[model samples]
Structures are given as structure tokens and as C-alpha cells.
Target: MRLTSGVFMFLLLVLSSVCVAETYNMETQFIAPIKLPINLVPLVNEHLDSPFERYGCAASLRQSLEASFVRLSPTAEPSILVKPAESCLCGVHTCSFWILRQCGATYCFAGHLHAHSIEINQATLLNDYYGLTGLPGGATSSEATHFLFDGKSYVEEKIEPKQIK
Candidate 1:
């Protein structure tokens, strides 16, 4: 129930394109263009849910969560990542997570990207340096992020806060 590497890798390209409008003082037109994996596009065009549909994909809910789990998860071995969407709208899907094995320990990550059926509102999306946004009911309106534990030490990082140009 997870997106394949090609699928997520394509999303990464999109993520890479979306440079925060604030830091760069760029226009919205420059936001990362959505180029989901071509092979998976058909399923999405048909409005079908990918394997990432089940869990909330909630940043916290996913296994050893990681944004790139859908693509680069297996390489890590004993790691995990959680998907997004604790309460998805389509009942089809919203987000995903991944975990991989690290040196003698497990590293978990929570990712929310490459959503297939989830409707997106680019204008409302937090166009910050980190390309993250918060939501209501505990979801941040700027960036969806939180502290994660490596099962040994806690990694301190969050989506960069959005700032005005």
C-alpha cells in the first residue's frame, strides 16, 4: 500500500522545483510543477487510489516516516515512515509514510506528498522555504511538520517557516 520509487521520485522532482516564493521572492508560477510518475498518472487520471490510501498518512501515524519512502525506502533496511491524511476525503487516499533500517537502529519519517486523489489548493498551500503547510484541527496552516525520533535520538527539524518577501 505505498507508492513505488519511480512514483515518489517523480514527486521529488516536483518538490525540488517548488522553491519557497518568499526566500526567492519569486512568483507563484515558479512553484514546483506537478509531474507525478508517468506510469502512475493513468491510475490517478482515472481517480483510483494508490496503495497509500489506508492510514491517515498522518505525519505521526505513518511507520518510520520519510518523505521519500515511496521511492527510497528499501535502501535503508530498518527504517519506517508514516503517510499523511489521518482523515482523507476520498476514502481513496491522501498521503504516505516510510521507515528504513539504519546502522543498528531504525529511522522513521512522515511524508505528505505525491497525493493521488487528494485535492490540492496550491494558493492556500504554505509556500514557505520548506514547502510545507499546516491545517486545521491540529494541522498547521503553514507547514505540516513535527519532531521525529530515530528510535535512539530525536531529529530536530521542521518544514521551514514561510516568510514574506
Candidate 2:
């Protein structure tokens, strides 16, 4: 069967979305130790150019990463509230607020400032979650799920951490 270009594109998009495995709304408690350079503490909420700016963020992507966090997680599900905390890693330069998976890895999603859209790269996401020392990243569908749903199950509750602004 010969497929039209338009139809092919649609199929590809759908498949790409479907190809992403299903992650759980699972939760785990963590005690993330801060490891940031000095002077960047106050500017943790600033939109730095790159997340690796040695001193502080002077970039433009403040909200995109916020949206991506929701797309990344099942529980927090990346909304304005679930977005990366301003000063991550204890007021680091520009590291994102990540899911910190149980498998020991992370998913860093940073969108361009002003433009509130996310860019989810499969290779990058996979590498980060499965790579060596993937700093506090996850949300890719590799999480374990609950077999049955109960009213009082963990999924029915919310985990609200006292965030440091």
C-alpha cells in the first residue's frame, strides 16, 4: 500500500508519541544534597542562557523547562507548580528541577525562554535516564506501575515538599 506524504507524517507523529513508554505516577522520597557554586544562590530563579553557566543563569528559557517537567512526570505532571524549582541543586547556576528517578538518573528539559514549548529528544532523554550519573532526571516510561488501583493507594495522594525559594 502506497502511503501519502501527509498521512505518513501524521502516522509518524502518532507513532512517536505512542512509542514513548508509559511511566508510573510513582513517588519516592529523596534528600537531594546541594552542590552548587557560590554566588548563584540568589539568582537560582533567573533565566540563564545555558543551564551550565558557571556563575548564574542569564538565559531566556524560564518557563519551557517548567512545561517539560509536566510532560516528563506522571504525578507532578509538569505544570507551573510542578515546574523546576528556581534554585535547583541548592541554588545552582542553572540546573533544572528534575524527577530524580529511582534508577539513578535524570531528565533535563529546558525550553527557550518566552516560547513555552518543549523539545523532547528520545536519544537525549534515554541517555540521561540511563547514562552514567544522570543528575536527577527521569520520567521517561521506564518506571514501575501499580498492578491494581485502590482508593487509598499512593497514586491517590499528593507529595508536597516544602520547597526553598
Say which candidate scores most in lDDT. 1
Residue lDDT tens for model 1, 1-165:
256988899899898676422211111121332222233323222322344443334432222121222222223342222223233522232232222224444232222332222211223312111222222122332233332333332233455677899
Question: What tens-digit string does per-residue lDDT give for candidate 2 at 1-165?
Answer: 356888999999998986664331112111232333233232334534444432333343332222212233233323221223234322222233333222213222222121111223233233222111112224432222111112111121123555799
Which lDDT values do the candidates have, in the order given? Answer: 0.30, 0.29
TM-score each candidate.
0.21, 0.21
Which segments of candidate 2 are over 4 A away from where they belong? 3-10, 20-69, 75-165
Tell me the lDDT of candidate 1: 0.30
